[model samples]
Target chain A: MFLWIIQRDLLLAMRRRADVLTTLFFFIIVVSLFPLGVGPEMNMLRTMAPGVVWVAALLASMLSLGRMFSSDHADGTLEQMLLSPQSLSLLVLGKALAHWLVTGVPLVLMAPVLGIQYDLSTDALLVLTASLLLGTPVLSLIGAIGAALTLGLRGGGVLVSLLVLPLYIPVLIFGAGAVEASAAGLGAGAHMSLLGAFLLASLVLAPWTAAVSLRISME
Target chain B: MAINWFKYSSPASFYSLAGKMIPFFSVAAAVLFVVGLYIGFFVAPTDFQQGEAYRIIFIHVPAAWLSMFLYVIMAMWSGIGLAFNTRLSSMVATAIAPTGAMFTFLALWTGALWGKPMWGTWWVWDARLTSELILLFLYIGFMSLQAAIDDPRRADKAGAMIALVGVVNVPIIYFSVKWWNTLHQGASVSLTQSPKMASTMLTGMLIMSLACWMYAIAVILIRTRAIILERERHTVWVGQLQEATQ
Candidate 1:
């Protein structure tokens, strides 16, 4: 059931390529804008890379969060899913997983490329990629809760950002810390381990919260 | 005889109970604030280190503590409301948010004032300050979510979800503080930890915290009364009260 939902979401997402592409471009533009705002110093960019990329990634994922439910919600498929006998939490988990695949995975794969723009070394780039890989799922999972909560609300996209961004802080800390530690030649072992623990914990908690919110929003 | 718990869960009964409680808390808060401020300004000797400027800690620490404390309380009210489908609890959660946000902003402002002389900068992204700033953002988020929804009950449940998510992530603030310090310890910046204070200073700070607690309760009660009136305006008791007041 879970894999089917993931595949279904992926198929639906594949048809709406512009939305996925927009998230990527928004991330790139936002990230590139930082260097322009801060000046062209490679050393400064290197130092700021972890924070910049993570924040941009966070914002980009927020863009895709609205798409998580809006389409199915509009089409009434969400009501069907809610009415189904299958566990809604599992369904929410599947949607979050699919969201990460469509939006988050690309960001992870593309992060090293951005890291290069910031003059990050190969080692630091690897750490950046690893951190995003672990961290972005946490973002998607947590974000699903926000997305579900705000579904059909008048305040729209920016409102979800207002609600969800604060919850992203710990993930931001460890994810950026891991990359920053690597950039400084320190082992990222502790930060990565902590990020993993956070991811696992959110994995259990976020979907249930999201599922409950979906039910409430549907009402 | 068994206590009738559900009676107070009703808006009309809670309204009268809250009305009765408000003046007592208001008086207590006023008295405590005066006592706390006197001890803070007079009884506590000038700090050996930062001097009079460190007196900002009296206000800053309590506001900071209340900001964190109220978020937890708000979340608990929201969680209980969500789980039990209780309207009054949700109203309390909603009422607590603005006051909590005020204290968070107060904490940040007061901290900045204190930080200037001690750190030679208004802000340094210190772990505590940064986390408190994020907390302000969290409170804003919760309130924003509540305001955006059209249906009150839907808003309550949706906000409850964020509140619960926030509760789960509350520990993140502590972890982020630890991680931030470790990540920055190697930097040349020597943002000093606050020095150990005199006993009088500690007493004053505690008293200030109590004052904040009383103030928050009084304010929340008053606000919750308004909320109850607005939400239950169509109820017979509220209508009768409105008629009597007019």
Candidate 2:
């Protein structure tokens, strides 16, 4: 059921490829703009790179969250899925994973390139990519709850940010912290471990919470 | 004597009960405020280090404690409302939010006041302050989510879900200092250890906390009564009560 939903969403996303690319472009542009805004000093840019990239990833992931279920909802497919005997949480999980695949993975792949733009050393770039790799799924997972809660509400785009951003702090802390720690010659292991913990815990918990939120929004 | 515990659980009953109870709590809160402040300012000895500026702890510590405490209580009320489909529980949760947010703002403001003289700055990105600011955001989110949904019941359930999800941050906020090395000091009044302050200072602080508690209850009960009236206005009893009052 999960794989089917992921495959189906992937095909749907393929049909509308611009939606995926928009998020990716937004991530790249936001990451690129930081060096310009904060002078092009290499050492300074290197120091700011991980945080800038991680924040852009957070925003890009959030920007695409509206598409997670609003399209299915508009077409009434969501209600049908809700009535399906298979667990709604599993379906929501699939949708969130699909979202991460569409939005999150691109940022993770693009981080090293963006990191190089900031003049991050090889090791720092690797840690930046690795941290986002471990962190962005948690963003997508937790964001599913916010997206579900604001599903049909007006001004939902702005409202979802207010609802979800505070919840994203721990991820932001540890995600950006991992790179900063690695750059400081502190092994990124502890921060990576914490990010991995967030991933595992959110994986177990967020789908069920988002599933309940979907039911609330739908009903 | 057999007592019916659920008697006041209904919005209708609780409305009148809260109305009667408000004055008592308000009075107690007023008295405590007077007494707590008296002791806080005049009785509690000045810190040898901080001198008079340390007195803000009476207000700051209590407000900070209440802000976090109210979030937990609000989430619990929300969880109960979601689980049992109880209107009153949800109303109480709704009513508690503004008070919680108020205390959060108070905590932050007083922390700034206290920090300027002590930390030599109005603010720092210390873990405790950051988490408290997030706590404020959580309150705003809960209230805004509820306000956005026109249907009270849907709003209740939706707010409950967010509240429960946000509850995970509370422990993180409480432990943020211990978890991270930051400018914020470790907890001075933890239950596991004897307080590391003068006895009079401790008394003043606890009394101020109790004053804040009484004030919060009075305000929340008053707000809950208003919420009850708003939600239950279509019912017969509320109309009759309205007629009686007029």
- Best model number under TM-score: 2
lDDT of 1 by residue, B1-246 (tens): 998868999888988999999999999989989999999998999988788998998998888778888999999999999989999999999999999999999988987888778887788766666777888888889899999998999989888888877765456454555555632122111238443567788788888899999999999999999999889888778878953359
Give me the runs in candidate 1 sitting further than 4 Å from their true place.
B169-196, B242-245
Residue ranges of candidate 2 with Cα displaced over 4 Å: B242-245
Per-residue lDDT of model 2, residues A41-142, tens digit only = 988888888899999999999999999999999999999999999999999999999999999999999999988888889999899999999999999999
Model 2 chain B: which ten-residue window has the lowest total lDDT? B236-245
lDDT of 2 at B126: 91
Please tell me what DockQ candidate 2 reaches: 0.84
Model 1 CAPRI rating: high
Alpha-carbon lDDT, every model: 0.88, 0.94
- Quick one: how many clashes does candidate 1 have? 0
Q: Count the backbone clashes (under 3 Å) in each candidate.
A: 0, 0
Docking class of 2: high
Every model's DockQ, to 2 decimals? 0.83, 0.84
Q: Write the per-residue lDDT of candidate 1 for residues A38-140, one digit (tens) a residue.
A: 9999999999999999999999999889999999999999999999999999999999999999999989988998988999988999889999999999999
Candidate 2 accuracy as TM-score: 0.98
Which candidate tops lDDT? 2
Clashing residue pairs, backbone N/CA/C < 3 A, model 1: none
